[model samples]
Target chain A: MFPGKYQAVHAAALTVVLLALAASGVQAFIFSDPGSLYTAAIPDSWIYQAYHSTDQLAVFYGEGDWDLLYFEGLGKVADQSVRELAERSLALYGEPGGLSGFQLETPLLPVEVGGLQGLACAYTYQDERGNLLWEYRIFLLLPDGEGFSIALGSNGPWVKNNPPVLEEVLKKWQWTD
Target chain B: MAVDRLRKLSAWVIVLLFFSVIAAPVQASAASSGKAGAARFERALGGGAVPEILKQYGGEYVLPLGQRLWVEEVFRRLVGAAERQDVEYTLTVLNSAELNAFALPGGYVFITRGLVNAIGRDEAKLAAVLGHEIAHIEEKHGMNAVLRQMGLTVLLEVGMLAVDFASADLLRLAGTTLLELISRGWGREAEFEADLVGQTLAVRAGFDGSGAVSLLDGVLNLDSEDLPMKVFRTHPDTQERRERLEANLASFWPPPAAVDDPQVLERLNGGRILAQAGRNDPRGRYIVSLQENGAGLHIFDLQLGESALWLEGASVRDFAWSPQGQYLAVTLDEVSGDAVWICDRWGHVKRQIDLGRRRASQLSWSPEGKQLALLISDSGSQGILVTYAEADALVPMAADLGVEYSTWLEDGLFIFTGDAWYCISPPPVVPVTVQNPVPQVLQRQRILSPTVIKEGSTIRLTRPSLTMP
Candidate 1:
């Protein structure tokens, strides 16, 4: 094809793509930790926070904790197998503290992420203020009693709708050594 | 003789008519006095007024067993400190959160839960409150209002003080009239006198004189919009009261050095971190856990002036340093479950206490650091469980109290069952019924054994053997 004809076709395609993107109303951006630990494409509409003065790599993506995605490097409080950790976590949440309205939505299930084995579960509960919250937690075991966890919290419908942000983050994760 | 008899009859008619005319207005005045009339009649009749007062004020609020004992203990101490030779004071904690503190002529003192919460765990401030009410009684500030309002003068003047003049209507009229008068508070002079006398009483009761000053400061610092104590309009002049108390304290021969800890403010600041100083530490090193990044529980040993991130990756709910500052017990909420892991200052896990099937809500250190008191609960059972700090020994200390609050008690630990204070340490070896003390200041203070409470909500604290004075 001639150069002028090719330019005409390309501009038309670009315009259609831009219009489709505008219509979708979903936007995401790549987030990389300042320490160059890892990076992931996260929803731009959700809040993304990183606590710099922390030993654990605690990061949050949510609306002021009410609805959000959270990631943390939970240091070893106990030396246990991945299955043992999963069981204990389930039990921990099932019991009462400030959470009086706690219920298990789904049993723990083994899953694989980033070439590592981990456990994931979904649950529903009311916080101290009695705001009904739905949460999905994933715990990944690391070497030397170290573990990594990611929590996603929102209303039940959003959580049950396969939380798009969690799927996107998992799909776009980029770890740097 | 007939003429003399006629003269005598006429004289008898005149005397009878004279007394009737004089008594009619006095009776009308007494009748129109309303609740004051009812209260006066009740007082003269010599039945209890506390029940009537409580009935009007939403009944009595039964604090947890352990807390009730603590209040009673405070009342007893205040009584002994004041050295009153007569007039037994009944301390009744009315079930209102209106920040009211008032006294009745019958040595009855009432304080609201709102005032108690405002005081926090400061017993000295609580004494300051009680002492103020005591002053109202001591100075007969409320009594003058009581007599004029309750029509006691009417009865006294007519010489009907011993008459059974109270009707059902009079009894119904007793509460709100007196309640309204007390809630409005005594006049300016009476309040100032109460403040001065109350401070002295609290100081004599072994509390630091600064408690009154601190309490006043707290009131002044309250949100200007909500302005807690100011709602009663009693201490609306918070700044003025503080200045007056401070000046009076300066006049004291030797001012008290009792200063309140400013840590509750820290606790109230979103509670993002758990920071606490050791009970018996001389160096005043505080251990704080930072949740930033879930990086780990960093033991910030501010004593060495070093911020150390010793532990990592554990979700910490709460933690307490041992008495000797030798051991730190941190409650962890982890995927492996909620557990209390005891660590040393050197970052070593000494003991991991996981109460299977039961959750440990609070951990308090013994003064000696030899043991730790854990407020543990399950779906059905709630109590204080004492465990050897470094040992694997777990002893059920008190199964009678724990509605999810706990604190330290001089040589032992006190746990709140939300409604009662239960002693957890020393295990109460001697169980004594000790005839329920209807201590003055607590006119309607009823010590109901958990078994006596028929309420399904409160019956859970069945400490059949738990008897505390």
Candidate 2:
């Protein structure tokens, strides 16, 4: 026997649950845009910034000291592996001024991302003012030899403090297709 | 309608089974791929038989349990510090009395017990040696050499087979090739690369960055006819490598100011010892030296003409006497983990600290004698920590100078050697000061050795007086 008061309560609970589900659906749709070729889990705390290029996206987080960069592009140079291309691109962008302090903390090692073989490296360098910064770069090779590179850069202290969160985000990264 | 529903149900079941069959294996393969590759590599290298084969050579020594643990701990720390978690390293000690260390593919590193004994149980030297071998593995020198010997088609086939790869014929060929490479060593370029890589790892692991240089010096001092003379053949041109390493070290971390005039110090040699403190006490002097067999430490009282055995049984790696001559800090070599003993002048152990399976080499007593400064290796977690040891507290100084040698100044400050001579105030506050304010010039002049001289109630440091431009 469903009392009138109980029936009203059940209907309200159902509506609330449906609304929550719809809200999450909307959030996922917004993050995984249909036009984008890749999708990754970004922490709710991060603020989405402008896309630098058609293939590159940047997001800022953590007291304005850290940012996550994503890039996907076809092979521009001939006869180079995804690892080489990624390293070359990183060296160009990471050390634009040909700085001397750039060091690879972790060499290019095998990694599995989005169920595909990938390569990853961690590097550290000092700015002109001598502030230590670290970056972890992971590159996933595509079937057509295109590559997707993800970079997480921040001060040393912040990266050390957020290992688990960073690992989770990398674990959830995937190709949209 | 019933027939149609049954057909739909059967199709759904078939599709579900297909997904399960495909997905389960893929997940399993992904989980076990790395382990399987490692296992295959191990099998190809003859598994446990590799150590036995190495023991066939005369003078091979099996490490005691404690020493084994110590070696493993050090290796683990080095690998972790290098951030190379992909390869699993297995360290083996040959019981032979040969000063040699080498690496094999599949994470196998071998160091002779004689080599450890020869280096006087110095941990930094050990780290440098281990780091060099590890660099060989990380850089894939052995594997690349083998692959070059064999064709690329074989490697491709081996790669394709993955976990189920090992072939007996291929293993035999690979094993023979590895042995040849080990005997002949990698190319000069590879060796140089290994030296740089090893130095980087050793420095990063909080070891004395000069460890590689020290090891090379020791090697150079060895008799040409020694059994370890094979090192010359395997590692060609030691003097050149040493020079390169010295240059690299200087660039990476500049040398501290010279503590003594090399010309003046070079003239006198006989009775003078490398005393850490009390260089100017004319009335009497204390000198610490290794026993004839390098088994223990001997403290000689020059004034009294008496010598006392400070520590015996284990090799004395390093030691320091307090400024006031009240206490002595001595480090003992072990296969497990080295121990640092705080003892009185009469050789009575007051406090013993176990460094848990890694090397604790450099020790410096605070000027006031209330605290002892220790250069402790942090493996990979932190570089080296300059720890202040008091009666019941072990406080780590916040300075990250990668201190190689440290001494406490009379003014309650500590001078540590890293890129240069930098002074830091004692904890609970550590403020750093560079001894020389001038920008370092890249000249290759021989540095003066630091000496403490006393003149009329004043302590004087007789270091090389450099004219700043």
**Best candidate according to lDDT:** 1
How is the predicted docking of candidate 1 categorized under the CAPRI scheme? incorrect
Tens digits of per-residue lDDT, candidate 2, B1-469, equal 9999999887656545533533444344444446566556643573434755475645345553234435555676678777556677877777677667888776778787777667654666778899999898888787777655554334345553232233444456567767766788878888999998998887776665566776786667667775455655888699888777766653343323333444433432322233545322223466777677767777676756877775677677767767777777778876667778877665677777777765675566666665676666666322233332323224444235565555555534334344344445442211111111111111111344445776323467753222111
Compute the interface RMSD for each candidate structure.
Answer: 21.5, 22.7
Q: Count the backbone clashes (under 3 Å) in each candidate.
A: 30, 13
Q: In order, what DockQ does each candidate have? A: 0.01, 0.01
In model 2 chain B, the worst 10-residue window by lDDT is B436-445
Off by over 4 Å in 1: A1-177, B1-49, B148-180, B228-231, B254-469
Q: lDDT scores for all predictions?
A: 0.60, 0.58
Provide the lowest-lDDT 10-residue window in model 1 chain B: B437-446
